[model samples]
Target: MHLVDIHDEFTHFMANMTCLSVMSVRYSSRCILAKKLRDCDRYTNIINYFELMYCDLKVRNESKEIGVLCLFVLIYFLFFCVVFICINEYYLPALKIAAIRLKLNEYLAGVLLVGVANSTSDFMLNFSAVRSGSPTMNLAMSNALTSICVMGGTIYVIMPFKINSASVFRDFLFVIFLLQLIRFFIQTDSPTYWVKGLIILLIYPIYLAVNIIDFLLMRYNIRKLRREIEILRYKRSSPMLDKKLYDKVTTLKDLEVDDDFKILRMKTRYGIFRAGVFVTPKPLVEPRKVDVESNRVLFHNKNNPKNRFLFTEFIQDLNPIDPEHWMFSGKYGRAALICVSPAMFLLRLAIPMVNYEQIKHGWSKLLNCIQIITNPFLVAILLETAYFTTHNNSWLINIYFDKALWSLAVTVPLSLIVFVDTRTDIPPPYHKLFSIFTIVTVVTLIWICSWEMEVIISIIGSVFNQSSNYMTVTFNAFSNAVPDMIAYIQLSKNGYGKMAFGGIVGGIVFDITINLGAQFARSNSESRHLLGDFGETIYIFLLLTVFSTSWMCLVLDFNARRSGGIFLWCLYVMFFIYVTLIEANVIHDFTADTVIEVKD
Candidate 1:
């Protein structure tokens, strides 16, 4: 053979060998992958099963069909009713029972549990979003604030009743304060003091007390007016009297009488007389005058310098302590308390939970066994604060807002949520009832919660994927907010309008403080970074919230006109524009892309 022909034949042989090697490697890799899949078949099967289940359980049977869509629409309504009834019957009662078992006072428990339940949906969504590697911290926080705004708008639009109660303002102020306080805490890189968390926790009890007191005061005033009306009618029945006699008897009604007092006589020439109203023939005992010159004991002489002073008796009465001694001594408990109470308060506020219960007993043992398990980090925070404050240069009380000490402020509460057994220490009968109740609540809540989110992501997400802002408004907003809306409507219907309003405020507060707090703890650094990036957007929403709430209160002074609702609706529109154009930064400006590009 010729040398050129031999070289060409050798080249073709090499190419064929290379192709064979490639085929062998590819087949070998496929065999390995198949072996691995067979070994992890359980996980694959589980995932596949859940996928099938989800597809089967969708609310919409066919997304494109009109008739199917109508059928699903009706089914959605039915589903909503079932969930509502489940919540009303099972969920609330379960919470109430759990709270009672937990020994939380009625109003406090109501605020905590009801607020938690209403905002649970938001918490779950935020958790899943972050865990799924989505940028959701800003979305989560803004969604919470926006929920408050939506709630206020809905209240105005539907209820149209004046919230003319001190309780309403009080709740609003408290929520505002809480939001601001949390914002301040998160601003600093310094470690937060667990004591500050304790202080925030303390606000709930005080809030509950204030609500109860306001309710009692309102009821008392109503009862008192009714009594006065009844008495006035009897007064009118009396025969016409001389103006002097009428004045005398009018003054008689003003007498501060105890329950011992009784109406002995009515409408005689002598006029009305009740026991203890008039003191008859009692000998007067005038206060002894101090002898300033002699510096000795004195008697009932009004001419003495101390006695002659214009407001001498008033001054004596006004003395917070024992005026007789003019010092802290016996009978000076009130004075001592007044003087030292603030110091004591500061002490409690700074004390660590470690110092609280080394050995938990009785009620604390029963309810807050979880709470007693103190985190070392929290104790260190308390100690740091104590040391810093007690040092000679301790004028940095204001630094509490600006600086942080080491803290398990979030961790401790998060643990309580996970580990604290609600059924712990209950007796047999109640324990069984609680178990059954809790199981039902858990199951029902789980089912509804999953369904709601699934519907939103699948149905609403598919529809509005092009515009995230639309998805938020049309579905995300309504899905999370509907629970609160239902709560408000039911509360109003049941004549607990103030409480209904309070529930909304309470729900927002709970979500922000406890629910959001826990999520932040779990993903603290990421949350902080996200907040830093999106702080402005959050503040804008917050400002809108303040304005909306203030406007609602102002408009409430008049009728809650449809105009007010329209204004709120406009405000929400502005909010969406701000979120989309400014915060989300989907659009650079108002002008068209072409115009912006030309300008550039």
Candidate 2:
């Protein structure tokens, strides 16, 4: 009985151990499945994240592209608007005047029309140049050249008729000769400081007065002419009279009623019989509706007076008719004319005074004080004088003598006046510094005239053979004749006048005098032999020297005190380097081409 019970216990223990092993295996399988599931979930999540990121990137790129396209469209639209405005404001008015006057021949008229059209662009360019603060000399020279090329070239190209060379020469030569002589005289004289100051102060006022007077006279004449036309329209005149008379009457009425028209009329006494009248109007025309299918107005018959009456005209004539009912009649026109004249006069006068006052104070007085202080006219005169005096020897010597005579004549009186006018507000140090700087600059400019002449002459000699050089000299002289009369515009918004002038002078001196002089001087020396053997090395050395000098100057000036000093310096340097590099590359390429040709 005992042995059987022990066997039963052993069997039961073995079964329990087997069952525990099976349970362990099942738990291990479950753990493995859970681990696999977790890994799969993580991988799925990562994939989804990547897909979302890609979608977002695509959306962002599309949005950026749309923004750029929209910007381009806006810019294009603005450009068109500007072009249309230019045409309407300037070109159309001039063209209509030319057409009416019949002064220009058919070909000439076309040329004049084109020129008038281009004048808007020219005006904008001039304005832009003035804003840029380019020295007067640069502005005048550039404009003169551009105008000559544009006008002369266009005429030559478009006109069927050949230019009468003899006539052209006769017409232009005397004027050119006189201008050159005057320029020569002006350049030699040392202008009294006081005289210069007075002239500078008075110039804008004189210009304003003259312009205002001219405008008033024009307005008056236009008004008178319009009155005469209105009177004629009211007169019981038969259509059998002059067709011009009938048209003039209608045109007068049209001018008054038309929203597009802003006419100015002036009347002059041409004895008791009739009055001399002048009329002018704005250039734009209002839009009109028409039947697209028939290519005509959707109104009554053309011959009917009712159909002929414009909508604007009908609205304007809605008031009860009176014998004295002149369109723009009574005191309205006179009052408008009077009001505008005084306002304009006062503005013109006050602006210059304000500018001078600001200058008397410090730049802190006004953020844009420098721009105001350096007037366009003053800048132009100074620059033109500098360029002509430097480039043309005869002119320089003449101007020097003239300046000396003027100085002696005006100096004492002018100085006395300035002294009397001297204010207590001016600080002693500032006054002293300003006077000294002015004196030094003037003296330096006068002295540099001779040096500039020599350098310019040398450059001419080096660049061309004798005849070509002579021609070039003549061309340059003719091109620069009317220094004072030509308009000087600014080229940049920042006041970079000093730097621009300095750079120009430096470039001219270095290229014409230093480089050429060095080459000529070294031609017979041992350095010449070395240079001949290693020409590229010499060129490289010269280039590097220029680069270093220019860089150093830029660095020094970059830190120097002036308006927009550092920023202007950096801009100029970057522009100069970029231009120089481009030019150098072009020259190098050309030289390479020539060398290859020679070898071949």
Candidate 3:
């Protein structure tokens, strides 16, 4: 070979190596950066999400009542649609994806994440109500039932889903008893309601305990069944075995194993434990070989035709950097994106997402610099979380659980950011150590979104002059239930009806217990009437619904058939309409005790 040719080939090899090195760095940087957040499509196309909702606005100086019909319901509903999509599509799904990474069962994931995380927003409203010395438990309790009806009830209409009869039955019984107890408390108007609430709150841990026990017993029964099968196999094969014994073994082999635990034997696996069965990830932590993607929910829907609508598909899959789904793909989309780029950039800065985002090396570097300089609040939050969750045994990691170590926290993350190379595409965001904070990061986003929801509700209520009860029952119920319904809809869509339904019930139980308890504990209302004039109508209707649900479950022998689901869903809609009419004064407000006497 010629010397010139050999030298040229060597040069070419070195160039290839350099390019590969650059690519490798970019990939790792993106992954570590992902630990910074759980990103969603909402981060992109910010204008598309917010634009149409405001296009109908007309500034009016008068005609508030007329405005209520056009502006309040229609415009506010658009706003609701946007927020609902955000929560159902991104926030809750992100939490579920995290659970999947941890390899937890779907039912358990729903109960734990959906049950507790929802309180982020609810507590804010409850806190506001308590600060005003208002009775807050009514809203929380009613919202629980509404959430179940909206989520669990709707699942039946979609498909005939058999529930884990024992677990669901236990949950329903707890809710039934608890609901009745709440009714009594409302009737009495006890000042020691806080104590009662505290007592209820304490039951949550016990509920969790029961759930864990039930899960263990379930595992044990699976083992027991397998053992019986093994014994039967041994008896069938044994030459010395008696004919009668072999015949009995053959008969026992016909025993069934149900995944949903529908049969009486399966349902009664841990009968004693059954009595107590009422209850109830980063972006991801995966092997180095597997690509770590946080938008598992988005990708999973790609192939499912049912999950897609041809019109909204683009919005659903929007990833700004990904050319395939980029808004810049079309002329109008490009123009719109450019127009809203500034707003979108600010929103991105406020809520950064990391995992699997194809952020360019150059832009990633620039963004790091820009965000650190412009958004010091983000820095402060990152620093604060790092300080507390340091995972180090050092005393410097404060035990006080307060911001006293703010200075230290600031210094540590700031110094670490430099070494973490948050500036460059390859070197920055290589902070794999910070991956643990992804939960905190996603949670912060959920919390911010939730707080924003409270603001939205407050704004709408102030405009309409709706009574607090009406606001809590209708707006609060719809807001809380919508996200939950969307979540359970996903579960049921995937044929995890049992898991979906279990989660709905468990979530309601959580709301009624932990959430309701908090409300009661915080409440200082002097009002003798907890139920406003017709508030008892909702409670009464909910009780009847619960009784009907119980009867439906029994008739089907715990099978959640479509017939039962549609019936319950229809019932819920009727209930919602009835309540709405009462609020509108179209129906009789039967209780004279409806209005709480207020101190001026």
TM-scores for every candidate against the unseen true structure: 0.46, 0.23, 0.60
lDDT of 3 by residue, 323-428 (tens): 5535336877666556545534443443323333222211233333333333445535544543333312221222232443454546456655553443232423
lDDT of 1 by residue, 24-86 (tens): 233224223322222112111111111222223322223432443354455455545545544
Report each candidate's C-alpha RMSD, comma-separated, in the order given.
25.5, 33.3, 21.3
For model 3, where is the 10-residue window of minimal lDDT? Answer: 278-287
Error of 1 at 574 (Å): 2.6
Rank by TM-score (best first): 3, 1, 2
Point out the higher-scoring one by lDDT: 1 or 3. Answer: 3
Local distance difference test, per candidate? 0.43, 0.29, 0.50
Q: How far is candidate 2 from the true structure (C-alpha RMSD, Å)?
A: 33.3
lDDT of 2 by residue, 1-600 (tens): 899999998766543331112112332242233222222121111011111212222213435434533543443333333233223222233333333344332222222233222222222222221112122222222233222322222222221122222222332232233223323322444353234334333433443354335434544555776777766666676765456566665654433331121112112212211221111111133223222223212232435542233344323222223224335557785554443444333222212211111222211111112222322333334444433332111111212233334333443454344435433223122232232222222222222222233223322332233322222222322222211011110100111112122222222222222222232233321222212211232223323333443343344442222222223334334433433443345323111233444553
Sort order, lDDT high to low? 3, 1, 2
Better of 1 and 2 by lDDT: 1
As for candidate 3, its clashing pairs are: 34-354, 34-355, 421-428, 422-428, 532-594, 533-594
Worst 10 residues of 1 by lDDT: 354-363
TM-score-best of 2 and 3: 3
Output the worst ten-in-a-row residue range by lDDT, candidate 2. 484-493
- What would the TM-score be for candidate 1 when compared with the true structure? 0.46
Best TM-score among the predictions, by candidate number: 3
